[model samples]
Target chain A: MIEEFFLRALIAGVGVAAVAGPLGCFVVWRRMAYFGATLAHGALLGIALGLLIDVDPVFGIAASSVLIALIVTGLQRQGAIGGDTLLGILAHAGLALGLVALAFMSVRIDLMAYLFGDVLAVTWSDILWIYLGGTAVLATLALIWNTLLAITLNEELARAEGIDTARIQLVFMLILAVVIAIAMKIVGVLLIVSLLIIPAAAARPFARTPEQMAALAAAAGALSAAAGLFASLQWDTPAGPSIVAAATAIFALSFTFSGTLGKRAA
Target chain B: MALDKRSAGTGLLVEAKGLTVRFGASSALDGVDLTVSSGEIVSLIGPNGAGKTTLVRAVAGLVEASAGTLWRQPDLRIGYVPQRLSIDRVMPLTVRRLLSLAGRSSGAEIVSALAEVDAAALLKHAIHDLSGGEFQRVMLARALLRKPHLLLLDEPLQGVDLGGQLALYDLIGRLRRRHAMGVLLVSHDLHIVMAATDRVVCLNHHVCCSGAPESVRHHPEYTALFGAEAARRLAVYTHAHDHAHDLAGNPVAAADTNHADNEPEHLS
Candidate 1:
């Protein structure tokens, strides 16, 4: 099974896509694509710290991303700096720090693998991490689905209905951190937000409801993973970028079909 | 009206005492007291920055009072229709989905709730696709789905045309009659709702005047808060309706005729 590297990559990539699809809907709804990018960029710092402390890189990524999410949440409330500017500072700072740390490391490191993903290099243990982490994120999202949707619609309305909006927001941020941590190998830090956003955006025009949109996003993402994997094998293209390219193509196709449906509905 | 007052014993849904809300340094709402009773329509009227929204939010428990005591019925269920909820065009949410936000509602329940607000045909429509009047109906439908004891409507007539506004007011009046739900509405258009509202509270950071619509229209506090011309116009509108009655459930024929005679002069 270890010999079938491409098969392993496909499985890992599909699993990540499934989780990223629904989570991505919130990203699109809340306009948190840049926030997703910041968390993904911080994963590199986690990897560096993991190496320095002799811990698993996955754990390192999860911890660092969560820390960064908390910091962003805290800073956003202070209102001293705008949200996008804050995210830009954190994104670049985390990426630069991670790169510097990697440079100073005594052991040889393949920086390209972390930056653009090394799906072909994934081991069976990596599959376990991806599925386990992905399942946890999915389960939490399901448990809070209604509450999250309510909050997304209007925070004040949700609060008036007795929902703990602030706590739900915090939990949502944590789930995003976990997803970024586990999805690193499938799409890498640079392309992680793309995977989280593109499929959801593509599925939007065709969907009539939130649940339908989520299901369609997952299907679109999985299809992209399978198609992209095949394309990479045929063209020798990078797997992560190829997956994103396939997603973009699907999005373009949706526009053609969705316009008529939108017209009919109108 | 007497029947409602008797049935809703003590007639209290929400009571706020000396409610004050401060944002950093400035006070959005200061030392305001409000009472909403079941089977009653209480309209909060104010100009921009008058803390009408703050008062509504505070009563809905969306915003905590910096210094005040707020009381509610032990089993109070509030249905809130916000003044403006900007639904992002990107998200795909149908009217049915929005109604199911609190929890899973049966298809039949969804249909009936939509019908309650005269939006049964819009159940399948995407939220972003609906026109402003249609959207307000959907919002009202969603609020009704909660089977609330109290309905908090913030400028529910906004974006609705004159005809639609009249129909909505009729529907709201029907809702009060059917469910006996307490309604606390924030309205900018005093002319439209003056006849429907049982009480009118004029606010400008504090309660300028609050009483029966007829009295509030004449209160110096209300006239001072809103100009004398505006008060005269409100009084004219209030008396223009043949169906209008005083708070004591009596038809004020003399008052109506007096105002009807004065209406042209005020308009001129």
Candidate 2:
């Protein structure tokens, strides 16, 4: 017999995985893994803000991640500093600020739970947020899939084709913020990007088409979540890192299996 | 196929007057006046860092004109082939998928556009596997798929071999005659320009000289700006090149008929 809490954790993790899979494909394609990490790191400040205001950390995370993403977008026009430098500054600064703010709070905060996810402790309400938020993300992703892919191929080309590339990129970043907001409970702050890029990357060699890659990536993510959950149950490991480990293992397997495919993703 | 856009009076596709673009304190382009009319072929040539590309980008609305006014036909459809399109090696894409980057294109349209560029067979091939010349042809097909009113080619002949360059230039002339498309081409190489090109605008931060291809090459400013060797390379290589060719880049037909009629009178 399955425990209700484990069932809930399984459902929530799987929901987040399904959504992150296709989105991760874009993350990998645009080589925005650092950007993904930067946003996830910013989610901690959001959790602290949520605690300060007596609001749900999920909503706080959504607000902070979106704010950080927009700020980065706007400041990218400032020329001198490279994008990675900007992202690194924002990422570490946000994480440290969250830690400092959390330290000042009166309520007993389980730092471990927020830093690395306490997936085994997931509640039914968290599952609700996961599915509902994941649905919206998947729908929005489908609508902008082609346009996003075009811009990812070449921003200048897409702009010349009359696409408002900046607007599309902004929209994409917002979508990513929502993903971070909902997936935070599943994989915590630091491992969110691991859940994103690894599964998508693992699915790369096997896919002949982009749509195929997205579907395969989603499949890979779901299995990693399930397998990771099982391993956590068996070994009493932390659920967030276990999920990421499972994802990495799958990537290793894919790399080994696809070695004969001749072409490798750079 | 020049389906009478000129008669419909699309007139000027782009008109830029005294355009200036600056990056930080340095200027990329300065005081450049240029225009492209419907059914016109204009070539932009200059030395490296001459802002040839900046002018093209400004006209294409890719860059903001910092100090001057630029005008374009309302709702202008532009087919732009950038100088370099380095496909990300990780992205999974095929030639057939490339043509629809602007928007959705039907299979027939895709096939036809690829055929026009002599790259129809590359439809199923992964873009990562393509050679440089093959990639250029596919990019051209992608540009054509837009059925643009104004076409922008930034150094389109860079990777093509000499024989293929002659053939591709021939194809560009045919496109102008058939579609009446306005072409704004940027060329770094002085090796060749299309026989049908109406204007050659020489640039070195400013409009050094501008006129018909023949007169521009002979202008005193043109000679002074570009020394003897540069001007000598600007000499037009006019030859009949309409014959069909196999994939090996060899002419399949020896029939050279009236294709030469399109060249300047001095060339014949």
Candidate 3:
């Protein structure tokens, strides 16, 4: 039973790493850390909608995250308010609304399972969705990788070269929504932001290029996921938090090592 | 891939029609009309708040023009090197990698672009380790690597040393002659503007003057836009000899002030 649990977690962890690698690179590159959180929080609303409508929660999550992404993009373009202020309002509102909606559900649901993922409870079907969603996200990201990196480096420069930033941004956000929705199962909504950030941040100091950054981040994410799963198994801790904790540990170690290297070079 | 369409037979790489830009209440650029013909290098100059950057950003489409349109030749590819190239140092990147990030380019192309700005040797160096001049050259190399039909540069000489500035100027000269690419440069270097640019556009929230650099200097509108004192200061900033110490015998505290003093005012 323990071996089976470990194997299941490993499959799910790979799915998360595959999506997080490239998406996380963008998160760090575009300085979209808060934006990543916004999308993650918005996933809760997706969950609530899914449960309320008797549909798959992942579908609901993708839809809700996409909607939130669109809202943020629209407000930013329209200059309704500054991005951070608007994000602050939306982030909390989404969380509050999700909680409120969850409370109104007629049947009691294990809300903690969604917030802090129960990786062990992931069925074979859930594993299929994870792989399918993760593959689609990675393929799409690879196709537009150069263009996306160019835009992230400098928006106007990209535009001048006939790279449609608006179109590219829409595609990027859509992919991010899908990734967030699917990965929410492995890491949970609350901690999904960590998977997107910590691995990427950890890989940043060592990367020579954007490609290297994404590759290293993916490796770091997968390693952390494995390490976290083993630690959680030994200690009987919750899966999602344990994964994030392990990722944080990796980040701490990388930060210290990279810092020392930087000082030595200086 | 659709060809970039521009106005027919204009020979101008970029044309701005009644371009106006505002930041809140005050107009940063007002009714500015300018043109940069193929192979022509146009330099924009003005006082501190004279809307030099505003005009350039408007042209680059970095900032939307409150009113007016900017058109470029259908095939014109613009490369914009912004004034502030400094990002968070924690952001790890290398010069060669940054250039390739623009688009896929051959190693030879990358080498040539770097060679143009004399940054070829530092290709593998991390961005954080690069000097101000070297950093700017990397940006230039990135821009050139794209083989743009038009290059829009904002304060390219801002942090560069005299040698770097001259080297970049030479590269710009080569680009203009070899590729017939139009160059739109915004600089406070008044001395080089007259010599470097085929055309000079004097701007102070409007088209103060636009013509040959020497001719623009003689225009009363140009003098009136800056007034006598400011015009003199701009003249001083432009001239190499005028970089002498200020009233207190200290070097003029300007963006171009070199690192010889090793002051804490590291521009980055």
Candidate 4:
């Protein structure tokens, strides 16, 4: 029974790593790390909505993430408030609202499952959603790869070259929304940003171009997920935070070595 | 904003009518009007605060024209090479990769564009490691790949030294001849602009003056902006900025302007 649960957790971890790798590249490139955290925090409200409405948690998370992304993008375009201030408001508001909604629910809720994730309790159906959602996000990212990269380099230059930046930006935000929704299930709402940022940051020292960085980040993410699974099995640590901790360790090591090698190369 | 007949029949490719741009309360460009015709290399010359960058930004569509209309070709694609193409220096990118971001271009086309700028050899090198001059050449190469009808260059000759500037001028001249693109180049190098551009348009919160490089050189307003010596130097070169030929032997550049002599010292 224990081995079966472990096997399921391993599969889910692998799926999460694959999705996090390329998505993290944009997070690092656009300097959207804080924004990722803000959205992930908003995912908790998504969880609350799922419970309140009796819908799938993933769908609720995606809807909430999309809402947050649109609001942030719109507010930024209007230049009404500073980006960080707005993000802080939305981040805390989502968390607070979700907690309030959880209180009003009649049934006993597994708070730890949503906060820290339950890889050991993973079902085959959950794995299916992970793969299906992961494929959709990755495929969309592949289709608009060049266009997204162009906008990342310089929006004005991209527009001058006839690439519609507004549409591309909307697509990117949507993809990010989906990634956040799926990632929430694996890493839990609070720690979701780790899966998106840590792997990419770890791969930073090794990559030369945006494409290379993304590939390397995904590879690093998978390795960390596997390592974190082992650590969880040995000590019975929570799977979600364990994976994040493993990624953090890898990042520290990479940082030390990359700094030394980077200095020498220069 | 009225344009004379000579300006109207000059085959104008781009017309900026009463272009006004403001950043907060300060007016960067105030009711500025200018026109660029086909087969001419025009220079937008002005002092540091003369709205040259603002006008260029408005033309490139980087900034809105606040309260004016820009009339150009319906498909008026522009190639922009900014004052400094500063990348994160840490990011690894090749010249080919940089060009690829601008638009899709065949390997042969890329080589041809690079050859135009004499930067064919630096194609494989990391762009961040390139020198300022080589970087500018690469930028020019990338811009040429778009086959732009209007090429807007912002202070192309700023940081580059004498040797680099001369090579860039040669490349610019070749691009102009081959593409016949309307080039609106901005430069603070008064001495170089006097020699290289066909016409100089003096801009300072407005179109102070615009005429042939030689005529603009003799205009009192032009001399007032940059001493008599600098104005004469502008008239000498034939868009090449190389050595002065027969028509370039004028020594008026050596004659110090009375107004230029008494101005307060301003270091760049």
In model 3, what is the error at residue A42, expressed in angstroms?
Answer: 2.0
Q: Which prediction has the highest TM-score against the true structure?
A: 1
lDDT string for model 2 (B1-268, tens) is 1222334334888999899999887778877899999889899875577789989888888999899889998988888888887877667788887776656788888888888888889999988888767887888788777778888999988877765665677677777666778999986554245556788786666765566655335445545764544444344433333453344322355345533222234331
Pick the winner on lDDT between candidates 2 and 4. Answer: 2
Tens-digit lDDT string for candidate 4 (A101-162): 88899999988778777777888988888889889999999989889887887776777677
Candidate 3 wrong stretches, greater than 4 Å: A78-80, A260-266, B1-10, B21-26, B61-71, B189-194, B210-268
- Determine which window of 10 residues in candidate 2 chain B has minimal summed lDDT: B259-268
DockQ of every predicted complex:
0.64, 0.50, 0.43, 0.39
On the 0 to 100 scale, the lDDT of residue A241 in model 2 is 91
Cα displacement (Å) at residue A41, model 1: 0.5
For residues A1-266, write the lDDT of model 1, one tens digit per residue: 33499899999999999899999999999899999999899889999999999998978987888788889889999999999999999999999999999998999998998999888898999999889998999999999888999999898898888889889988999899888888888889999998899999999987888888899999999988888988999999999899999999998898877784457443
lDDT of 4: 0.76
User: Judged by DockQ, which candidate is best?
Assistant: 1
Considering the two chains of model 1, state its CAPRI-style docking category. medium
Q: Write the per-residue lDDT of candidate 3 for residues B87-145, one digit (tens) a residue.
A: 55545678877877867787778887787777789989988788777887788778777
What's the C-alpha lDDT at position B21 in model 4?
A: 89
Question: What value does the lDDT take at residue A86 in candidate 3?
Answer: 89
Ranking by TM-score: 1, 2, 4, 3
C-alpha lDDT of residue A175 in model 1: 91
Write down the lDDT of every candidate, Cα atoms only: 0.81, 0.80, 0.76, 0.76
